[model samples]
Target chain A: PAPDSAAQGLALARNGQLTKPPGALGRLEDLAIWLAGWQGREKPQASAPQVVIFAANHGIAARGVSAFPPQVTAQMVANFRHGGAAINQLSRTFGASLGVHALDLDQPTADFTQGPAMTEAEVVSALATGWNAVDPEADLLVTGEMGIGNTTSAAAIAAALLGGNAQDWVGRGTGVDDHGLARKAETVRAGLVAHADALHDPLEVLRRLGGREIAAMTGAIARARMERVAVVLDGFICCAAALVLQRLHEGALDHCIAGHVSAEAGHGRLLAALGKDPLLALGLRLGEGSGAALALGVVQGAIACHSGMATFAEAGVSGA
Target chain B: PAPDSAAQGLALARNGQLTKPPGALGRLEDLAIWLAGWQGREKPQASAPQVVIFAANHGIAARGVSAFPPQVTAQMVANFRHGGAAINQLSRTFGASLGVHALDLDQPTADFTQGPAMTEAEVVSALATGWNAVDPEADLLVTGEMGIGNTTSAAAIAAALLGGNAQDWVGRGTGVDDHGLARKAETVRAGLVAHADALHDPLEVLRRLGGREIAAMTGAIARARMERVAVVLDGFICCAAALVLQRLHEGALDHCIAGHVSAEAGHGRLLAALGKDPLLALGLRLGEGSGAALALGVVQGAIACHSGMATFAEAGVSGA
Candidate 1:
């Protein structure tokens, strides 16, 4: 079931009686009410949060579409294991268990400019890999990704799914120079042109233009909804995967929260399409689930304020 | 001294080698550099954070200037004492020591519409009280306030300091109805008009048209700068206090960060006057340092990413 409106109302009423003015907590109050509704209780607790980083290599790197080489993808996975990556430090700081899934780092996707990024069967397998990675015991889940040149694939997928020019969606992934950025934009354009027939079907779009990590993230989001776990989405790549999931399941975004707005070009349009407002907008463009991991503390803080705060009646404080 | 430009440049250079693209971390990188410069160290740590909630009563409440009665101010102070207020909960969540100081809760300031909010001597004493509240051992300080109808006082002070009409500065504080908002606006206009002779001097403006808590907050900001402590400023009321400090001392904002943009009407103009970009934009209007406390984690995350995470060269990962 969706969040319970009755619990939300009760929480809202309780907030009015708290020591502060009505709606003074602003989005924190709304967050508390939403958590109450989602938890089906007057007070919700965001305990045992988990973060998963889906990583894979993109074949578009062969075309010099990204500033960083594809080998960095495998290297970053090792960094995650060694607790040296930004996501690792963030997960530890925010008290979330970090899970790094290197889904096909050894097998780069086919260059989508000329052909489908992955076979249909590979996409399904990747989705299942993401779906099965969810921990039912987690109170909250955050989705993140790490793949060199995956931004090109994400941009291609976004352009096809969102119906805009490739130039509008393409950005300087990994601080690519002007030439590399132009090449990436052209690569997305060519991929979209090649997959025009498949663009209408979300699944076909994922197989043709999206990388395995994105497909996996979509599956992860779907599974999180099915398991009734709240998901905090990272930046553009994760949001692109969410777009695919939202298209397939109309209410898929009901369980998700945008953690931060990415510095990518099309992210604003993508977020608008999903009707989601991000909590933080610090211009984060890192893709290793860093943005989402940074948001875990905020979600926890919101839940703590909801579950642990004292009401006016309880605190012997006068109401407004 | 101001933030060390050399340290900031060094940190910026270091960020480029941290596996992600240059400027990929966005505001987080900037935060790291800012902290580095402020602390005069290449790596900074937000180790000990302190939050002070200055509570007082507003005489303007008798004129129907607020939704809540004046007694709620004293009642909320008791709530803070018992660790039941939102600021208390946020303080605990962010690992900050919470201090609630009721400078003169039983004695409401004189209604500014009729006369000065406080005698000049009382303003100086309150400023000293706020100045002495700073913990020199603390790494971060957060300022918050609790006073009914204080928004009216804040709006009036902002109108005088920033050169605006009362209607532009007035907002529906504490969920005031349209009639109450209109009354509050009128009250500010009256107060500003009454204090027109003192409007040119920032301290005179605070004394004539601002509440005791606002005066104390101004002192706190000034003291934080002197103590070299980083301050996370709360919503509109706190920003109003900061404007006074900034006018009195040009570098008062050097140690401050706007925690969030309040829902108040004139807060945008106030923040613009100070040239501040708030970290959180959840429309929080709660005054008791709740927004600043909530921002502690984000600032910490930025610092951690700067100090703890590995560089691409160290991790054998290719840089953008």
Candidate 2:
């Protein structure tokens, strides 16, 4: 669904009436306008933001592609639930609600290097899990992931969808050394070769090469568009999930904004591919919605200024 | 005085024990460490941040350099006092204390193109006003300005210190047209020529070519270092203020970080000369402490994560 054009038009006019120069706020002016359009209100608000975390185990962990074992996925989920993780601290700092959903952490997806990562039914179920996780009442949404070896899956998906080589999409995940990075790249290459036929269809590509958490992020983002909740996409794996949706539907990610470009090398490339102008670039790489939650402050600040500031006439200030 | 290196070392050790992988948080990790050092605590806090706005009139407005008239500076300061400006909204959003100071708004500085912008006594008083504006109880600080035609003054100062031509440092401030831009460049050149003899000393350069608000920002930043409060520098004029201190004393801006790289053309060049990596780059050009106030969220988030997250052993999460 397209955003309300009337609200956007009204916001544009209001931006010009503010005390500063026409575009003095720069991207923040655009952010307020974008929020107004999505929320269907000339005055947008960012009071209620939601952050959801999807956790799953990828079978690719057996390939020694990740520094930590797959069980760490379940462990981190426990940490998130107990409010002991970085995302939890960020959520608390921003007053954002944090939701953690673990998708069959004990049952890992099939290794994509050997065969399809998930059957069509399995992929559909994971997508539904993600879609159902979104809160319709949330004015803003951010989706994050927790899956060991998932970077390898995201790399394979990018290689399939964006036509990049495995090395181009792969980066060190969870502090992997040089040899591990090389091995991860090779693993992605093998997965791409195995899933070559399914690359024709974006959903099929997701089913064959995407992990459950990544697919869940895809579903959640798609659901955000339906619910009229603006989304802030986080890091590399989240962008890979958005890629599947961007390829699946024309203008699918229009309601979404790149929260921040991470330190992961592939993230910049993925942001470029997604046609997203990222909001923040603090060299952050932590995935569990930390970057997006941090950016919630910026999004909130933009809306606050848009709604809270007085126009030139109201302030009795002269304009150019 | 330098930051507490002992606290920084302890904070570094604590960072490695957090649940996430080593350096997974990227620049945020460094921010946390920096905060810890400045605050002299292993567990840094961002509970209170102060934003100070200095307003003045520049005589160069008579040269038709800015889009708005000179009177608009006083008008905007009144708006700020009434809590009707963008900075007011941002301050409310981040819970920062805002102090507005109008430095002799009725008296515009002398035109620098003909002679020094301010007498030595006037410049010293302006700096002292900035120095006295800071709140010692605040944990973080941001300095902003409201002065029409001040960008022209900042450009002349940048060209003087950084060895650039007037055209290289001049930009379309407050949305000037091409003709106004050319006029601004010529005005900056004239100011530089008029003040050539006094450019040998940093304070003399500030007195001869800098506006009151710009000098105020310089004094405020230096006061922040003395108080051991971490500073986040704003846009082009603010950087030009910082440059004076950076050249006057070695490592003068060691306690400061560039808040955001603004859309003003000279801001990026000024940031590069200072060797300070900016936190946000949303192309913001509004100079009313808006960029640095927006960045307060990121700094708060970094410290929150650093102090709030549980250690790997405490969370029972697997480590690499």
Candidate 3:
């Protein structure tokens, strides 16, 4: 049996116990009804939505392509641990469990103990680690990422996937000026030129130019598909991972939902390639599952409207 | 004594807290710290924010200026009463109170006769009515409006206030076509020209060209200022009322904050007039306080950061 899409959910929405006008809840109503079918019930609940923020070091950061230093990754990861990052604050507000994982793509670990980025074996292990951290019966999953200059990595990965110049996908990251942006674009072009043939396979792409966190997130998407857990993808970095996962397994995209369309330069092209419409667009460039965290609320609204609002029949209102 | 706009409830953050290095939380920390001071409390709480939506009929609707009929004002008001409007759902989600007031601007109650766009007596009474509805002691006040052909009315009102050409301020209302937009702009020009001499006073301008809801919202903004409550202004119609309120009482402008800059042609100009920075700009043209309602979460985040979250010294972190 295949996982349900919004169309299937809309169908089940018609059968709900309440008899409201069709599409009464608007987007929210539609989402709620869709979720009900996904849950295989009349009402779907998201009791425990898990969000994973994969933090990685980007090779482009070494080129002074970002306003902040690459060290901000470790600094932000530590901040996340301390509940100071925007993602940490937002996840707490939404009552979603947030996990942070480090992907070693830009810089080697102290003593060079950890492999660069991650090998296929490491990616699988990391996936197992993240999956084990969540309940086997988790209701939903959200994928997010954070890395200074990761936009460059994302653009390069996107260029490799879509056969475009990295210059086409590079954008302003953390408010960099025109000169820094130019350098960032140049660095992406260089990385793509260096790793073009090597990135033909998704795993090779991750190994050649992908960050450790990107590989793990790809694995997480693959695992979430197998488990039939609903997955929401946030912004550029996670989209790169989802693109990889989609290529590795055609059906994996079925479990995925694009949370929001980011204003990042390459995000639109990536979304087009993936054939997804983001649930929201607020010009948010801050990636950290903030978009997915917001989508959870939308999903919750959908569920509530499905379960709680009085239908036209119940309210005795004439149908449209 | 005047309300202390400068009372240092919280300091503008130059450094991140959480016992971490400087600049760890990045822009979020600065945003949080800025909000803390603005709220006038060490821990400014927005648990019960207010969202006031004012609805009226526009004289320009007489020109057949909108997709829906003018009666949709009353119909949507009924929708609001029935809690079917998008803003209603959003307010419920944010735990904010939604206040709807009818301003007799478009179609006055006759024989039981009141003038279109309430008289000064009606405006004062409506102010009291709306103010009394705000719980008097709420944390924040959000003001938005709905009126068919309101873009025409709003543009006229804004032009009168800014002393600009009406056509320059006018935009398409509810997806009006090029022909409709041209006609609408012409209507604004006509209204402005007709009302210019009569609108010697801002209140008179509102009465001459504004809708019932705009007048009511103007009164509400004034009352919010008198009571020292922060008002979050939404889009052009609200901006029009805000301009009226500012003209009537310059001090009223001090109590207002911009929720988002609308994609409306004149919204930016109006916002610039008041030296206000809108918190978000997502090209939103939907009325009903949708943009303002969306911005509630950000204001809440600002308040939470101000009220919650330990200070650098409190968290034992180094300061800049």
Question: Tens-digit lDDT track for model 3 on A140-192?
Answer: 88877777777776776787777877678888756677988898778767776
Q: What is the interface RMSD of each candidate, in Å?
A: 1.2, 0.8, 6.4
Evaluated on chain B only, what is the TM-score of candidate 1?
0.97
**Fnat scores for every prediction:** 0.78, 0.82, 0.00
Q: Clash pairs of candidate 1?
A: none
What local lDDT does model 1 show for residue A313?
80
| Candidate 2 Cα misplacement greater than 4 A, ranges | none
Ranking, TM-score, top scorer first:
2, 1, 3
Model 3 chain B weakest lDDT span, ten residues long:
B108-117
Instruction: Tell me the tens digit of each residue's lDDT in model 2 across A254-298.
Output: 999999998887999998989998898887878998888889999
Per-candidate interface DockQ score: 0.73, 0.84, 0.12
* lDDT at residue A250 of model 2 (Cα atoms): 71
lDDT against the true structure, per candidate, is 0.85, 0.92, 0.66
Better of 1 and 3 by DockQ: 1
- Highest lDDT model number: 2
Per-residue lDDT for A202 in model 1? 89
Q: Judging by DockQ against the true structure, name the best candidate.
A: 2
Task: For residue A111, give model 2's deviation from the true position in Å.
Answer: 1.4
TM-score of 1: 0.97
Q: List the residue pairs that clash in candidate 2.
A: none
